[model samples]
Target: MEISSPPRSNATDLLVSTSSDISHLTELLTAAGLELGPGGTDAHRPPRRVLNTPRYAAMQARFDRFGSDGITMMCSTAGLQVCLDMGERDRVATRWAALHALGPVLLAVFANSARLGGRSTPWVSARTRAVLGTEPARTRRGAVSGDPAAEWAARVLDTPLICWRHGGPDWTAPPRVTFAEWIGGALPGVPTTEDMDYHLSTMFTPIRPRGYFEVRYLDSQPPQDWMAPVALLIALFEDERVVDEALAAAQPAVGRWLHAARVGTADPRVAGAARAVLDLGLRSLPRLGLPTDLHDEVTRSLDRRLAAVPAPHGGDLR
Candidate 1:
């Protein structure tokens, strides 16, 4: 399941592919019996009540084999996560565009891991919850609006460094200190400009607007379905019409990111946006030469989730 590198180009027309590296990681884990079930166990049972040692051993063995590298594992502070390489020049812009466009689609595609603590957590994507909980600056933010590169750079420079890996726990600083502050000599240490730059690189948010915006929001979708989000994102960005339509449809759910992340497709606004986005996606799929069946699958899933929204206790939609 090795993911090939994307074609070398900053052209909007380039079809951005989903990295197979993540697929390999997930498959290895699953093959080793590390099933990503709701709460990591079956219904009517407490989570982690039954540990599978052999499965864990297999996973450890696999990890030991591949090991780590810069491109292989970015932002160790945010955990070993795979980030798409969008070349050098427009890295942040391309990453941001891909992330924002693909966020909801990925969320829909990888809507497994619904249960937590051996109980349904009302979210269809609990793995996403675990990701966002990784670090504040990296995973907490909502969508971005404006030039991707400048915005990303500004945000990164302003976000305080949570910790420097070198200094350990003793290197901690005031909670609100920004990278700018550290560079301005506000901290005890006479931090260099290079230190500021390095610190900025570590911040991870769901939709980072760095040189290439990274979509850190999706759960580990099934390997087979991995291409769905990638395809949807490429189509949406490459086609201006699709981008406009998706933006229009997702507007209602703009400020409700927290609600969406918390309850997933359960919330009416989130569900509505999901439906709109899928419908728009289906209409644009033909232009991209992608199979209509994929769009249909997305549409059906959204419809099913929307229909499953529980009736209000008092019969009110609110």
Candidate 2:
């Protein structure tokens, strides 16, 4: 279910070619009486292997208190996460900041989930809305500052634990208890390095930093259009200059997660910012050394998206 490109390889090109395999697989499944898209109905009833696992059991137990949002997110929705290198150590802060700044625009641009539980929803990215509604403490976007590493470390320790491993069936941490409290002997056992590693894996922040940048904001794209966002992101973050330019272009929509998920590019302000970001990404694409046809495919995808919106909202990309 996952495809990883080799290190320093061209992700856009790989996605473009790999899509054929995906399409073929989809056809095979369809012939066998299977259908596939963004949403699914199996959230309420996961497979035994998935549901019976200690990790999932504990997670479900913890999320039960929050209502059905967590279950819906885990069961129904799909995402097209893009992971990239953190780049040079000195430039990490800049890249991190730029990604956060550009996140809302990206979310709005690729918003796809419009329905949940067989009912039409107001939000464009209903999956994202479900994520925010489930748990803000651990799932929301992390605060950006000059010191990302320190801020992230502190945030990790301060946030309440979802679950921790134990030999017994019950892996759920005590309600409202944080990892910091466990480290201070609030729990029966001492915290270890492995425990810290597991804790990091539990974080569901919009952008997860684990020696690499995991862009988790994007909704799963349609099969034919999957590579557009990937190419645009690569181009935007490929150079410092592009990152700064894209960040400024998307500044108007910064921190507007709810708005982006609700109205998407329908809002003139968000639409304007999205247009500029897409244009900037397009302008920077040539530097990526993509093949002519592949580059044109990306261009067409971006153009199609831009043209889909009303003129009043989608201003000229120039």
Candidate 3:
């Protein structure tokens, strides 16, 4: 598929959200006869017919056909790829801005498998669980560092690969083989730095800092809901005051990342975090020149989801 890059300013930063089991979700899309590329899965893909032209009509048609299957619409600005660009001092800041900005938007846009095991799951976002289950280092929320690029590079070197897609078959590497190991001749191909970079790209995580940090932890939301997260992210990050508010709001629930994904809005901690984040997002919306209604709707949805389900057991939510 030809992926058209968004405007440079918009595409510079990226946020990735994945279903609980993205591989399975990809399979689902394939079964539905849709091909997903590096961008998103199934209905989430930009309509093939609309490339290089107005997307409104085609986007609407795709939504009409498959929006209810829990397809999420995400945004990526051209700015995100600048990590590969040299002479950028504010690269990490831009990435954090994107991530912080996208948090609530992601929450709002979240749509995922409502059913699992051939039955309707109580949670509206089962994809969150699926992605969480895939890998811990990549999906789990780690300590956000001051420099996302450096932090991501260091972490990438440490995270072991789940599987490597070689030609036609996936060669399963040792679970403990870190990027550092591969780079330092552990894998024995005298891997180059470029190869190491490519390897890092393959390790899917919630907060990854390559050329850009991909926030791969959200369930696909409806198409109409796409702009909410995009707008929210841009607002929160670009504006200093909004960033402060967001961090404050996110702090309360920072510890609940696992619970939020595992039990979603059900876990009280997760609920609290959702509420806090939503509250902050609403307060900041006006300042960012975005709509507060989006914030309100998202907050309401999370509240309802939390109230309806009981928290799951185990070692934190995915």
TM-score to true structure, per model: 0.61, 0.90, 0.58
Judged by lDDT relative to the true structure, which candidate is superior, 1 or 3?
A: 1
Q: Tens digits of per-residue lDDT for model 2 on 72-142? A: 77767778788877888787888888898888888888888887766778888888887877777778998
Best by TM-score: 2
- Please provide, for model 3 over 166-251, each residue's C-alpha lDDT reduced to its tens digit, 9 standing for 90 to 100: 34333556556776787677675665666666566555455555454445555544433334444444545555555566666565
Give lDDT: candidate 2, residue 45.
Answer: 39
Instruction: Show where candidate 3 strays beyond 4 Å.
Output: 1-5, 8-111, 146-150, 162-175, 286-318
Clashes of 2: 0
Residue ranges of candidate 2 with Cα displaced over 4 Å: 1-8, 20-24, 38-50, 312-318
lDDT: which candidate is best? 2
Sort by lDDT, best first. Answer: 2, 1, 3
Candidate achieving higher lDDT, 1 or 2:
2
CA lDDT for candidate 2: 0.80
| Cα shift from native, residue 168, model 2 (Å) | 0.9
